[model samples]
Target chain A: MTNSIRAEWTKFRTVRGWVIGLLTAIPLTVLIGLLGPLGSSFDCAGPNGAQCRGNTPPIGPDGTPVFDTFYFVHRTLTGDGSVTARVGALRDAEPWAKAGLLLKEGTTSGSRYAAVLLTGGHGVRMQYDFTEDIAGPSPDEDRQWLRLTREGTTLTGETSSDGRRWSTVGTVRLDFGERVELGMFVSSPQHLETSNTFGGRLDRGAPTVATTSFDQVRTTGAAAEDWRGTAVGIDPAREHEVGFTDDGGDLTITGTGDIAPIPASAGSLGKTAENALVGAFAGLVAVLVVAALFATSEYRRGIIRTSFTANPRRGQLLAAKAVVVGGLSFVVGAVSSALALPLVERAELAEGFFQHPTTWLTELRLVLGTGLLFAVAAVLAVALGMFLRRGALTVTAVVVGVVLPYLLAVASVLPTGPAEVLVTVTPAAAFAIQQSVEEYPQVAASYTPADGYFPLSPTGGLVVLCGYAAVAVVLAAIATRRRDA
Target chain B: MSALHAEWTKAWTVPGTAWLLAGVVTLTPLLGVLAASSMAEGGDPARTSLLGVTLGQAAVVGLAVATVSGEYGTGMIRTTLTAVPRRLAVLRAKAFLVCMLTVAGGTAAVGASVAAGDALLPEGLSIAQGPVLRAAVGSVLYLALVGLLGVGVAALVRDAATAVGLVLGLLFLTPIVASLVSDPDWRERLLEWSPMTAGLAVQATVDLGSQPIGPWQGLGVLAAWASAALLAGAAALRLRDAS
Candidate 1:
């Protein structure tokens, strides 16, 4: 068994292509992980905005300075009422920019609210309490009808490609009352983007007011006949402040900052782990290829025949390969992630954002768990190769199984339920292990994919992935005994 | 014509061709049903209905690449060429046969997948819808073109493993790398040009304006990629020794 292990190890090291693939994993991980945060710390662009801003944690009583500010065309909705209008145009924008309609508890920027918004380029979103950006329709053209209806505490957001037909974007039970404010709004966050990797400079484009026009307004059920509006969260020294005008026919609003649910103050590092762990996917890809090729390449070259002749014990041979591939993948995943975390932390902190400090044990668990994820994925790939005996089939199947779930779950366009379902069922369930940000069912903050929560707990998710690997390995073992090489 | 028959026979005789094609048939609808079943009420019905095409294309690529590269692996390409001394003709024959098989499999797979989607989805989604019809038809062509891409890459590399990796990487990874890019316009451009992004864009029923490329245009981009790949494969086949 030892000799077989050593021989297999020799073969693994001998493959130059595999070695290069493994070596390249580190830099790809670094590039993806470290580079994502380059723009996370950027200050707002344009005149009078030369200040440390936008990076402030929205966990404030008044919310973050860059966000939680918007100009509104408002009216009081005492009961069940819907605010609907056709947005004529959205122009002159920022990346994290938005304009839409909202149902709010108070006119205060940090107030509990439900809104249907059209982002500058990111598409429509139904956001509540300043953070939970539910995927909305990517409507046809720039023209869209936005409506937010309130019945008691429940708010329903609907959009229309044309005014006659409506698609419900989403519904959320906001913590608002009967006499809540309903209005049209526009705001833009500080626009900073990472054009390149860490070596490349961040583009801090000047913040611009996203001027938007809302026409053909109609209201039903207890709406204010004499509607009033205001620039919520105005700052005396704020640059490019939100402004508005309500003509009899059309309402034009210009604003800066987001309108959603926000906590009272900067408390903990909610998204820091997600920020640090951008290397996970890149590392997983590199590891997946190398791990998959380990077993499949043997069959590809007919070297498995020679190896079987030497070992005869097929299970031992498979086991040895697993050990080798699993260990290599683990080291790759662990080292890359360990290196990535600090870079992400520095980038986050440098921008004056508070990353609620985590325990050392938590960090250690994340690093080890990330490594374990790659290792299990590697072993699974090996088993898949053995059973399938074709690199293309196995690799493709594994990718479809693992990566597809993650992609669907993260895609802002898809509904959140399928994303959660995918995470629950697929091998990507292991990603739950990397999910350090715990979603408290009680703490009704912004816990959406903008803040992600896996359906399963970390251990449970890993077990699901391990279950896949185990079943595949068992089938491969049984078949190895019965099939011809 | 005989060469085409010979290549077709060869593909049929291969160890897992039936299973591979069967896999395409079964998995397409299975994934489509699963996606549709899990879809939220507000999700794009057309895009959701044909979501299986994305997964099913991998099987098509695998089958197509294997049709060519397996011959190289087993040293049967020499016999294939000896039987048909015109190397380009043999390549073309293989290309023609693979594309036909893919299109046949693609049509069944896509048609059934959409049917499953229509069955599984809510009331608003229908195959009768214009965008859904285009998406369904375009997906078949997309699969056929992807198969050609596989055949071309396999011929160029002369190995199943490397060619599969290369094709999958080109089809899948570029979009991922492009998304990581910070420049919005550049990212959109990257998506517009990447074969997978452009090709798969055909399925989008809603939010046409936001797509990097139009549905027909996206399929055209994929078609261009397939053509370029097949031409390159033919050139490689003619220029190099049979090995």
Candidate 2:
């Protein structure tokens, strides 16, 4: 058995095609992973790791800043209340630039807040926290009256095209405090530069300022009767950059600001860690082709006779081949994933994207788990080859089983429920092994399968893939034992 | 007519032909049922139910490739040539037989897929009407063209692996590679022209307005691809020495 295992290893190493495939799978995996984030060209100066370790508002778990920065005017509200403002047109606004009435927990970026705001170009939008963007009616009126009413933690947004009849936009339940900042605010992101090329924004955008005025500002809720306005996010060094005047019934505010670490979903892992596994599909395809050919090529060349004649025992041959292919794939997958993840994380950080750094253990699991996924997938591919005895068919089976489902599930084309079901059943379920981000119950998000979630835990998903592989191997063993070479 | 009849018998007589054809019929609806069963409300039932065509095409390609390449593999091509005398007629007969078989099997598979989808879909999905009918019939045509593509590519490449690789790669990889295009216009063009993307468009009935190409137009693109491959294959057979 040892001799046959040694012979199998020797036979595998001897194949130039297999060696080239393994060698390419590594760099291809890392490169593909890097390419996704690189394509986005993430640019931000939001969170410094050490500064965010404390998870200060605006700063996320790994010190990446959540979008929490905005000027505020307030009187501590004890109970249910409302703030109404007739918002004047914003000047030099961005598409996502916002100015409207808001009820916020505090001055921090990630704190719970919901606002009915007039956007620069896309019309009215209702946004809560940092993730949810609910579209409201696009009334023809340029100036609109917006109201945000709070009842417990639930905030309802209303917009009036003519300040006479208010129409409900939407309401979101948020976690908040009794002493909340409720008032009107204005913000504009950096000036965006459009590329002549077709891909995403290639240049880091320049910052721009926007000023918006509010007329007939009034409060009816418990905290709104008496109001004091203060600019919370104004850096002392950058004094006079952003300000608000709340004199009597009217106010004007201006600033070049946005909640930091803007809203971009890179799986649940965010941009920082999704890079770790982005190349996984690219690498897996190469591995599938090589692993499948490892079995089928012998049949194609009619060397199955020679292989069995030398080994005599079909089970030993299968076992030895499995070990050799599995070990080789593991090594290739691990090294490539290791090289890709760190390089991508660094590049994202340099590009101004803010992120909480994954722990060493999380990183280790990411790299090693990818290795295991490919290893098992390769073994499965080999088994499929034994069953089908066709290079194209077996590779297609494994790819359809793994890669295609992963793509479809993540395409955002399928709705949440079906996408989740897809990930649960297919070998692509193994992808859950690489998930490092935990979904918080309090956070409002899509939380769909397309958003980097598996219905089963990572280990559980991997177990699903393992189940298919075990079946294939058992069938291969039975056929090899019973059939002629 | 006699040559066509002879080719018909030749294709099914090959090992695994019947099972491969059966696999296409069984797996198509089985996968379609699985997809349809898992769908949420408001989904285009026609598209979701016919999703199995993506997998079904694999078997269709295999059947067509085996029809041509299996003879070459067994040195039966020499005997086939001796029997027919005219090589082009033999290739034509083979293509016709494979296409007819694909159309027959594809119709069954697609009909089963729709029936399964209609039975399994949670919402009101009418399989008996409108774009659904076009989708079902067009899917059958799509498979036939893909089968012809397999036949054409196999004749050109000769080796089973090489031919299967070429056909499947053209079918699957073009869309993937095209997706990397940053410019939306070019991406749309790439998708519109890609054989697999355009061919599969026939299965899309729900959001016809949003599809890159119209159903018939997309199928036309796939047909154009098949015609080109067949033309190239014919040229190869006429120009190259027969083993």
Best by lDDT: 2
By how many angstroms RMSD does model 1 differ from the true structure?
13.8
lDDT value for model 1: 0.73
Computed on C-alpha atoms, the DockQ of candidate 1 is 0.08
lDDT tens string, model 1, B84-134? 999988888888887888888888998888778767777545678788888
- Candidate 2 segments exceeding 4 Å error: A21-65, A69-279, A335-364, A390-392, B1-6, B71-93, B120-128, B152-190, B224-243
Q: DockQ of candidate 2?
A: 0.06
Poorest 10 consecutive residues by lDDT, candidate 2 chain B: B175-184
For candidate 2, give the docking quality class from DockQ: incorrect
| Sliding window of 10 residues with minimal summed lDDT for model 2 chain A | A194-203
CAPRI-style class, candidate 1? incorrect
Fraction of the real A/B interface contacts present in each candidate? 0.14, 0.07
